[model samples]
Target: MKLKFLGKRISGILAILPERELHFDDEIGNFNFSSSNSLKLKKIMGYGRHRLADDDTCISDLCIFGLKYLFDAHLLDKAEIDALVVVTQTPDYLIPPTSNIIQGKLGLKHDLLCLDINQGCAGYLVGLIEAFLLLGNEAFNKIVLLNADVLSRKVSKQDRNSYPLIGDAASITIIERDSVERGIFANLQTDGSRGEALSIPAGGMRMPASDSTAVLELDGDNLRSKNHLKMDGGAVFNFMQTEVPPMIEDLLNYAKAGKDDVDYFLFHQPNKFMLQKLTNKIGVSPEKLPSNIVENFGNASSVTIPLNITFNLGQKLKDQSYAVCLAGFGSGLTWSSMFLRMGELDFCKIVEFVNKGD
Candidate 1:
């Protein structure tokens, strides 16, 4: 369960994105209809700063800012990174993938291996595992994994049930083979059958764009047309309650650690209610759960877990034997959990001495 760390390192992590303050009133409750009918209703409650056009700093830009900040903080030489991976379901463009866009903006070498993953929520963990494997070969040294998803663009603002809950954001974490921690212990899961429960019905190869399709309407905060995110909320919740706890337990067992041994539980920030439900079912104390950013950012899709970790680094995580469990469940109805042992920065010694009035 222990990994050798001659030099394996987590160079840095950064979350760079604006806070989305979405609001809604109880009047939305009046539209209680069947799932199909509900899908057509304008459900999104509200949005913060909606006037900023799509071209103004997209999720990709936020991701790049995070990566750049991490690289600068770690003082990494530009020539050292050998590979880059970007994970997202909402890429900036459909043609060249966000990874290529990031590579070009960052000025990374064209020869450096670059790729994109079309995973939904589990994308970050899957991308991290891939980065670790590439580093483990010793052929590649430093690797950057960037995750960003702008779900707001796809969410039908007209749908009161879903519009108020989706947000946009991005995060980046750099992984190296020989630094601070082992990063991830493998125990990832997927359920393709349930994929239909959480997905966008159109805009893919199966349902390509067509002139016959009606022009999607944006009604206030809700989407008033055909193109919109569809979800069977009850089914998704059932899946999470039944499947996630056992998967996490198994992952901890494989790591040779108990639930109590874990210092922090960082689940995908779907919402405060969902997080609380999962924590109670898993029997983990409320204090052990990481504070979610969903209140301010809603659900940032794949970027949630990493952003939560980065934002809370210095506050709740000082010199602790931290066990980080990341669980991402969304779209593809896909879910994954990875365990890692994290050591906090050594700042206590300085704080202790300085506080003595010396």
Candidate 2:
């Protein structure tokens, strides 16, 4: 779908990661590969290290921590928050939405709308669209768009193809109405036929977790149990190579924006190899497109977009105006992108969980 945003701005973006860092050398024994194979992966997948949450941590915990940091820093006000939208595949519970849990913890207004969207890579784009649309209501002036997931727990330890590539993270983006009008343009799409290319086979209504779900199988390079995350790496690569470039082209054309017109192109940090391929295929210069987020933070799903904002252009975004093209692909067989320019954000930084539960 093509989208347009009016009277809206991404005022700030904050990302938090669990402080526990895992180095490749320490995790070499966990994978099913030889040292040489692992080294190759490190070089190709940008897998020197990635962070993981404590066994006791949750996505809401990370997101709440980030919100508190922003509030403490006076970057945002909890009382003024009109809505909370948390996009995650690993919510705290299937019953009450994680957004509600966060709303209560943060002590925001009772009337604040809370929604949970179970999405992955394409999540941030969709979350931003939701925030912009909510601004259509005259009553709602600010919305917290939280995109996060503890994906490490969903991947099996023995899965060499995926376990090493997954990382845990949460990002909080504050969107609000600004007098200076800058419309956010977007294009979101889904191809369900290719959904199975990346999925968790169990723990859902169709296939509840059971003894069968715990059974591990050697499915291609993915040696994961039915309960673990699965992926047809080749299929995902092919889709990125063929479909993603055109999607970007369509988004730019629909928005009447050019690749050169964009100051930065931030994309989901799937891996170094695929990013390189996409950069070449899409004809985006390496200087304007950055793909090292996975090398430092891992493929943090939707959080990667904000992570990129803070990681590569955090200070710049906080100090000046620049056109940005944000894209998220992989998982959901979905891909989406948006174009916008932001300046002088209230907050743009990454935090480590210093006090785990806090």
Candidate 3:
């Protein structure tokens, strides 16, 4: 199942930071409450409606803005896009799905195929696989895959443990069928038995919204006491150590490549510590790995992978095979990894104009 990497194109790309920044507190009422016994600040990141210039706008609005920018960049002259796939867990609405909203806002033709995948961090890789499968049929020529999530919206502000780590952002990628050789070698896996390693417990069919369902208490800092993100940090670390490296090895073997063949390793941007551990365990040198945006952008869920490719990788390496191993393990305890060969594009031109402030 070889697909030519016929030059992929990206359109709209935008990121915004919220006004309020939340930091981690170690002391609770003159007593050390933090596990580390030290107070450190984590950025509580989000983009409000004020930033969008419309109070009625939600996080999805920022996504819309990014999507429009991509369409314009592609220079499509009023052409109707064939398909729209939105990979997001924190969608704008629960019932109608965010893809439908995006489709309407973009004024895509009625015949457009629109859907949403609720695969959390692994969503982008899985979504890309779906898009590739659909586009590979030779029937559809162009497809738009959008990965956007405002994770800060769901984060519990009062949960000092999680409040400082989550951030929000959106990204859009336009995929088309071409004869170039830079798509994907699908290698995906999951373990539902250990699913709750990381997750948001409320606000789903399993536990729908209700008054008696206990309103999440908000502390003085505007952080929620009850609705915060929960994770067994140690358990997750253990799982990562055991699962990620071998998967990478297997994927490389399946793709007919090796650790030394990859131009750079772009795994899920979990955090600095986790990334370091994974890299060391996998025997990948620091220079060969992409920069982790956790410090500034935090975990953008599905957008992390694309953001790395767009902002970090850019056009630095050309004609090099990039082994992009996307491992998303959290919430449902689901994880998936896929290797893709990224060909060189004229990123210098794109960056020159963007940097020149044009």
**Top lDDT hit:** 2
Q: How does candidate 2 fare on TM-score?
A: 0.97
**lDDT, candidate 3, residue 138?**
59
Per-candidate TM-score against the hidden true structure: 0.80, 0.97, 0.79
- Candidate 2, poorest ten consecutive residues by summed lDDT: 349-358
Model 2: per-residue Cα lDDT over 178-248, one tens digit each: 89767788999999999999999999999999998999887764578989998888999998888889989
What value of lDDT does candidate 2 attain over all alpha carbons? Answer: 0.87
Write one digit per residue (lDDT tens) for candidate 1, span 1-358.
2222234545455555653233444324433344455333323212222111143445566666655655575545567778878888878888887888888888888778888888877787787777877776767988878787777777665566466566676666677765444545656777788898877777788886565444665444344444567767779888888988888888878777788877788778666666778888899887778645665556677877866676565443445546677777777767788777654532111000011111
Segments of candidate 3 deviating more than 4 angstroms = 1-36, 39-57, 75-80, 181-183, 211-226, 315-325, 345-358
Better of 2 and 3 by lDDT: 2
Ranking by TM-score: 2, 1, 3
Ranking by lDDT: 2, 1, 3
Residues 118-206 of candidate 3 have per-residue lDDT tens digits of 77777777777777777756556677777777776666545544545566666666666556544456566677787777776666788
Name the Cα RMSD for model 3.
6.0
